[model samples]
Target: MNAIIVTGGDIDLSLLESYISKNKYTIVISVDAAVKKLEETGKLPNVMVGDFDTLADEKRLEYYAGLGIEIVRHNPVKDFSDTELAIDWAYKRNITEIVIFGALGRRFDHTFANILMLRKYKKLGVDITVVDRCNRIYVKSNPFILEKRLVWGKYISFFAVKEKVFIESLTGVAYPVENKYLDNIENPSLFISNEIVDDYMSVIFDGEILVVESRD
Candidate 1:
């Protein structure tokens, strides 16, 4: 029902393992250096996607090849990043739900780009989420249901990903808003630090916005 893509970024192994155990048939993908982490953790990925530059060990490469995992190598000089390639591969396979790990790290530019990729995948009708130890990030352009159990904490924030966003309404939350208008270019603090009160929270937006469910 979902695909887990691990990139060459800082990740929490315990959290990653919990996600892997949640789905029965989760397609696991490793990108470059992440392959080493997966192999070390005894969670061999089903597919490997990247330029192979970050994957320096030849023996490990051969080992995965022997295991018959799908390896998609691209040129290091390519246009798109390795994570984007992995996302595209999952999109082509008709995998609607994709959970990406190890995508948030020291490289601020890479993290920002990966976050923006959420918009592209959302437009393709694919539900993609970037998950790390402290936060779960996604882009929402339509109404979405958020189970309280799934929220990282009581704190959830909605920020306009685009220049402007039309918020239809927010329900079942502590600081509920009705028919709110948010424009990042004009005022970036329109919606900030909202809390969920009920068992579930519903977010309805007419335009694209970044939703961050985070915990301290």
Candidate 2:
């Protein structure tokens, strides 16, 4: 089972609802502004977290409270983002995989910050994915395999989150790489827009790389 977090980002309601209906999500967390959208999904969150500063439907929270949904409100001046706090809540309960929607919205700072969480939670032994209408982003360090059928979209990209990333081989894709070291600052676009040509794509890498599966 996986957990899903809905943040205050631009999301497709139909897509979100379809995902919820098709998957087994033990926990559903709606951040402040996302509460309104969550309600439209016809599903109640297991818990709601955030300060009400950006809430769209403030009154609906009370309705959720009346239905026994746990409200984990935090102070507006807190350090961590509401999404991060919600992630912590799930992690404490032993949920290792988390999928977040609405994270890649208009706010570049928030979107970048959410991407960084992929690295942070990875260190804490949790896999976090930030997904939206066109992209699914995550961080990977170890050698991994991506089966074509399981890939999120038509295009796949890799980025070096750190200063440098050494990829021994990137195979089973349209552009295969061998013994290549990519510099984050210099060659960030070198690994973007590759397509899986075989049944599976495999990557052997030495450092952390941000993996993006996107559709145009």
Candidate 3:
């Protein structure tokens, strides 16, 4: 099944609205502060998951309860992070493709952790994406076709999240590379910005490839 997952990182409501309006998904799950974002946007999530630590006020918790939102609260001392818990919950329900919003532009550690978390779900054979106002980030395990869309982005970046990823073919990009190996680098700016030129692009790789479609 298809689902949209919103994490508690900084979010852009206008961007979120555009995505939701275009996609007809089965469910929407919010994590932590994303619940409040949904409230502000007049969009109710199907499920809300998080430990209430990010929320400062107790009244906010009560406010959610008053709205009859079913919140799955985890212990503050749990081993898995709240975002992990939310992903686990969705995976248990057999949700395959997940589009995540409000997942970037916050604490660097948290953002980095969540990006790595997306890789953990790769073995499950599910398509997961972490999105924000400027980018749609995802991990690619094998060869795939990417369609070009006029989103709020101009540059595309592909990094080998694992050791190395072999690119089979590329099109619709300014600096297109084919049959190349993207090695894990200390400085990732080498693969930071790329552009797409055609209607679609193809990427083939063996290990994990983290693709960031960004703007500016």
Candidate maximizing lDDT: 2
Between candidates 2 and 3, which one is better according to TM-score? 2
Write model 2 residue lDDT over 1-216, tens digit each, in one string. Answer: 569999988899998999889889889998887877987988778889898788745677788889999999889999999888889888888999999999987898888888888899999889998887788899997999999998889999999979999999999999999999888788878999999999999999998999999998
Candidate 3 backbone clash number: 6
Error of 1 at 207 (Å): 1.5
Q: Which candidate would rank higher by TM-score, 1 or 3?
A: 1
For model 3, how does the per-residue alpha-carbon lDDT over 17-127 read when each residue is reduced to its tens digit? Answer: 878888998898888777778777779888888887876567877777787877888888988878888889989999889888876865888789888888888788778
Q: Rank the candidates by TM-score, best first.
A: 2, 1, 3
lDDT of every predicted structure (CA atoms): 0.86, 0.89, 0.80
Question: Which has the greatest TM-score?
Answer: 2
What is the descending lDDT order? 2, 1, 3
Q: How does candidate 2 fare on TM-score? A: 0.95
Worst 10 residues of 1 by lDDT: 17-26
- Of the pair 2 and 3, which is ahead by lDDT? 2
lDDT of 2 at 161: 78
The alpha-carbon lDDT assigned to residue 117 of candidate 3 equals 82
- Which stretches of model 1 miss by more than 4 angstroms? none
TM-score for all predictions? 0.93, 0.95, 0.88
Q: Which portions of model 2 show Cα errors greater than 4 Å?
A: 56-59
Provide the lDDT at 24 for model 3.
Answer: 95
